[model samples]
Target: MQSCSPFDQAQRGDVEAKFQIFLTLLAVLAGTALLARRVNIAPAILLLIAGITLAFIPGMPAIELPPDLILLLVLPPLIYSASVAMSWREFCANLRPIGLLAIGCVIFTACAVAVATHYLIGLSWPVGFLLGAIVAPPDVVAPLAIARRLGLPRRIVVVLEGEGLANDATALILYRFAVAAIMTGAFSLTKASGTFVAILAGEIAFGIAVGWLSLRARHWVRDPQIEITLSLLTPYIAYWIPEHHGGSGVIATVACGLYISWNGPLLISAATRLQGIFFWDLVIYLIEGMLFLLIGFELRAILERSQGIAFEDIAVATLLVAAIVVVARFAWVYPATYLPRLLSRRIRTRETAPSWQAVFVVGFTGVRGAVSLATALALPFALPDGSPFPDRDLILFVAFGVILITLVGLGLTLPALVTTLGVARDGRSELVFEHENEIAARREALAAALTSLDALTDHRELSNQVVALLRARHDIRSQQLPASLDDDAYAATANARALVRELIAAERKFIHAQLRAGKINDEARRRIERDLDLEEASLTNRESGTAPL
Candidate 1:
């Protein structure tokens, strides 16, 4: 074979270097996540620190985060996963508050940043607004992770999750408007407002259509692997179609995920769901870990490029912007929480007014994340006439700084803050109630299933032995469920589960021995092992108190 050219050799070398960097990042991501779990800190925070550390290490390559990688590759799945997990009923029930935060608060924060930066920092209004739009939305991944773990009230969790899912669309739409205004040197409120409405309606409709089609196709195909593949593709199809046509694909993805969430149970198979959940969980975890690490790495690259700018000036601007972001949230949230109840007696009758502590927790949890950084990085280098984009570097630095402050600073403090304010006191009680409800529901369902079985036995010529076996299986399962997860009951369940796991281990050991002894073929051994594995997994779930009703 002929020797490769110098250009080809260089290209190959670059590819190899990038591949090595990717492998190294993966190692760092995994380690950081494990460390976070051990220390009980949010993984995102540690991952960010790890990235920053790695970035400064001698011989480490400069890692550039392309906006497309985040917006296109990373975002759709993150949004889709979150939306699917959200309860549509809860989302709709709390529509007013979610909208207040997702729509009103985003706009409020954006405007606040815009006005502050313009007056204090001397940036032009359009550019300032662009910066505002970049950092407006609270990140879904980091804050929600912390909130769920903290055991806040379910409604608070729902509101936060719902807000995170939808706010990006609002911020992004505003971002586009700001960019257009900057580029054209003119802006129209009326025109932009109407366009925004149209885009929202259109994207929602399209997203629903995508969800409908995805479910139907998956149902038709009826293969676990194929169905999972289709599910993976669903978000992208929902996202890219409207996005290419000038819509904020965020809403479309959210709508699609919600539609599927409500409808998927009946259509999707158990095998697909069971396997897909694990697959998606792993995918999201890796993506999230790597994203945070990359975000940290971005700091080094940004600092290198900002050699001319004074560190003090950047620090002051970052501090000012971060302060404004935090304060604006508090200012808007209190009024938004109480003002509606004051104005509308209907609201007061329908819902209890939340405690100020809960409201404070919500306001404090406004941690900016990767989306802000991505938006900042995505800003064009030049305007329409080839003029340099004003304060682009400053925006990037501030956006990253704000993310650091909010995500790390606020995230680390939120747990203690929730405890100090007693927001989770009711949450603990609610969880107990939920566990009891779950047990009740399971009993009711099994009773219904047994009633159906009795009916089937009477109608069909079923053998007594078959009927007895079926009834006994259900009885055993029902009996295994504890009446309550009290300390005594939990201890008994744990001991029982441990014994059962030991039994499963013994069975697995025997099966492997048989295979080794040639008493069973490899296929037969695998089949038996799978059954044993599932039984053990069920026990594990119950032991962890995570088994579904």
Candidate 2:
């Protein structure tokens, strides 16, 4: 009987089984997405349900996500992506509300949950506080999912996004302090507050530095492939550097992401920008799907870990804690939403009073997600004295309960809430506004190009054929810009552009066939491919009413 290490066995594990699981999971996610689309429901909620179902299948392997991996690998990129995509202008416009929700509401919720857990459940104070920290921050993804689908108000979306991006950092900081207090049996409010301030300041500085340096490097490395690679790596580096030095990596990653996004036009090529968007969209899709599935799989382990605790007690505790989590958000959100406006004449003059319905929706949308689960699971298994961590399993159970209740309960009802509140959907108006802006810019650019063409041709020798071709294209484009942005005019332009795109696609297919048949050399194929790519990109830009830069 030779001894084989678990690491060795894992390395030599059933490759086929792993491959089957990957393929099956992808299929499941694809199917779930289709169902979500068909039903007009949030895909994430569906994915979560599917994942839970999958966990109960006989002979399924136990899937465990290491806490550090979630914090370091998963959290950073997801946070960075959301932060980068955020409109800094909008974020600033809603800064007061965002700050109230992200910082003030998170602490308020934590304290409320802590009190409920300690008094109602009879958990130790530190453990109760630990549980509070775990569930304090609402997951940004779920609310944003519904917001995107429902075309919710921009202000609501911005506030939710800002809270999502910043709250995790706050909650996690408090979580670390709480965990330490539990482990060491020591506590310090002044010291923790000071450290919190230091972490926020330090991480912001580090993120700005990393972003500046990375952007400079990206400029130096002009290759699109390398630039995109650096873009993918940037989030991780931004996050890790801060965490390594006792700073809030969430803030650091967000700062770096925002900086790069703000300067993206100057730093990145248009092709890279297009490529990066597609890449990140796919990455986010896969990660979100896998995350929900993992959450579902954890159910079995979470249940099993609570062997000593009575099932009835667990049920009661889970319900009470979840209720507290929901009520606490409402407790904070209404005051946070309106109190500033009432007290400050400056605020009152600057901002409108949000409707109570909108405030209620915002409050109800606070769904616990992966961060809470990751933090709960990341709890130490045992104390330094070799005793088991107090109520660790119970904490995990409660956290998962909150996630399920909020994501399923709140997410499923949000559509009706929006309808009842009569929140005006402005997504279409925003698109029209952007389209009009693009047209105006294009009209000006064409005028300048024609002017420059006349001046240059006057000074230098030129062929009539070349001049006529350039002039003809610009003239046709100028004509395409309708005098009025009407449906009929837009449709006419779209139909014309569709023909151009079809021709480009036909040319690409023919070229691809030529390369496949070995009629073209790699160099020749590449040259043609580059031309085809530019043509396609331009066509896409035109159809989307974007600048063809």
Q: Pick the candidate with the highest lDDT.
A: 1
**True-vs-predicted CA distance for residue 11, candidate 1, Å:** 3.1
For model 2, how does the per-residue alpha-carbon lDDT over 1-549 read when each residue is reduced to its tens digit?
Answer: 998899878866776677787787899999999999999888889988988888789987776767787898889889888988988778878888888999998898888888987888798888888888899999999889898677766688899999999999999999999999988999999999999999988888888888898889888988888998998898999999888877769989888887877877787887788788879989988888888877877888887888889999889988998898899999999888777777899989978787787788789899889999999999989999999999888888989998999999999999998887777445456556766777789899999999999998999899999999999999987986777667776676677777877888898889889988999988998898788887777777665433222
Worst 10 residues of 1 by lDDT: 540-549
Residue-level lDDT for 42 in candidate 1: 93
RMSD of 1: 1.5
Query: Could you tell me the lDDT of residue 390 within candidate 1?
Result: 88
Clashes of each: 0, 0
lDDT of 1 by residue, 502-528 (tens): 889899889889999999999999899
Candidate 2, clashing residue pairs?
none
Q: TM-score: which candidate is best?
A: 1
| Ten residues in sequence with the least summed lDDT for candidate 2 | 540-549
**For each candidate, what is the lDDT?**
0.91, 0.85
